[model samples]
Target: MNTLNEINWFPGHMKKALDQIKERLKTCDGVIEIGDSRAPISSFPTYLDKLVADKAKFYIFSKADLADRNALEKHLDKYTALGINTLALNLTDRRAMQTLINRLSLVRTRQEERFLKLGFPAPSKRFLVLGIPNVGKSTLINSLAKKKKAAVENKPGKTRSESLIKVSDKVFIIDTPGILEPNYEDKNIVIKLAILGSIRNDILPLIPLTDYLLEYLLKHYPQRIYERYHVSLDGNCEEIYLRIAKERNFVSKNQSDSERARSTLLTEFRNGLLGGISLDE
Candidate 1:
């Protein structure tokens, strides 16, 4: 198994985002930590456990539609058992957005009651939605606002600044730009996997990462491999990628099959064509 140590990716803006988050933490009531459902462990920032220790916190497994449903359910069960208020939400779903709002309301009410018990004046409930780039934070906000207020894109680093939006009379959301870890050697691999759209099959140019994903998928979810692309597993990762290339009719100018078969496979995999596959599962 190739550990994710080879990939190196980190932007300078992440440090700025972290500083801004720290500056604004005092004004906020709690944090809504958003994580990619496909790779929750990788998507989460380890520093958050201490960063938001003084403030209330909630975890939202975002992009639930693309992740393995069973895996997500298991995660939810495990996290909930540990007393973490976790919610599995598909950001594109309107009803799921409503449910999330209601859950946030309940959490706020409980916190308000606790503060009241302590003889502290009840503060207005403010939540900051924090996540890495391209984890669907803006889309989630758009769903909640019921309008196209936040800029959303499939690419990473789209939201470069923080923007506060009022969702309701009692609930307000502070939308922060996606923050990536700085020089943290451990998470570099996971960041590259996410940028390559290893979670689903919408983006392309999937060469090295696609081969990695196929091998990983074949070893774990063989049934999904057979079901999605109708390819049998008889050989190694290279052979499987070639078989997919041949099946998809992606040929090069020299009458040779293009390497694009791997690219196409990756794109489809990221778009949920390979079924709701979760990398962490």
Candidate 2:
């Protein structure tokens, strides 16, 4: 097995965004940490804990619709046990979004109490939203604000700066660009984030990633591969890819197009065609 020695993806825009976030944290009432529910642990911006430890913190694990129900429930349970305010659900669900909005009432009340004690008028609640790359921070903000206030993209690093968008008359959210640690301490995290589309796919070798996904699915979700492609899960990753290539007619000349097979496998997983998958568990 090949291990990634290092993955340093911190760009110029990310540094600038971090600086702005630190400066603006003083004015914000709370912090909301967002991450992909499919790989919540890996996709999380764990580095932000130190920065937001002093403020009211909430965890919103997005894309819960695509995460394995059992695994997601377990993850949520662990967070709940820790006494951390955490929510795991689809970002588009209106009811879930309402629950999120309602939960923020406590944070807002606390901010107001602080302001009153300081002899200042209570200001609109400001929440600093932070997440790793491609974790749906903008989409959550858009859903909360009930409008297209932030740029929603499927790729990473789309939002380069923080934008204050009013979700309601008394609530404002500062959507910051997806920020990643300069380097991940665990290399497995890099692979997991890459598979979850939270990191750039081009940064790693495609074959290794595809193999990792294939092995994981075979072990934890063999039925998905069998049902989706009718391929036997008894073989190795290469054999499985070849079988899928033949099944999908991904052939080039006399040989199976392994590249296309790998790409398709990854795409299927990302789009949740294979089923609800949880890479974190």
Error of 2 at 185 (Å): 1.6
Worst 10 residues of 2 by lDDT: 1-10
lDDT of 1 by residue, 60-114 (tens): 9888888889888888898899987889888989777777887877775456878
Return the TM-score for each candidate structure.
0.87, 0.92
Looking at candidate 2, what is the lDDT of residue 165? Answer: 81
C-alpha local distance difference test of each model: 0.73, 0.84
Candidate 2 C-alpha lDDT tens digits along 1-281: 34476445676788888898899898887888997899878888888888887787888999998999899889889899998889887887766788888777656446688888999987778888989888888888888878788888888888876688877677778888888887777777888888888778777889998998998988898899899998777767888899889999999998998789999999989998999999976
> Considering summed lDDT, which 10 consecutive residues are worst modelled in model 1?
196-205
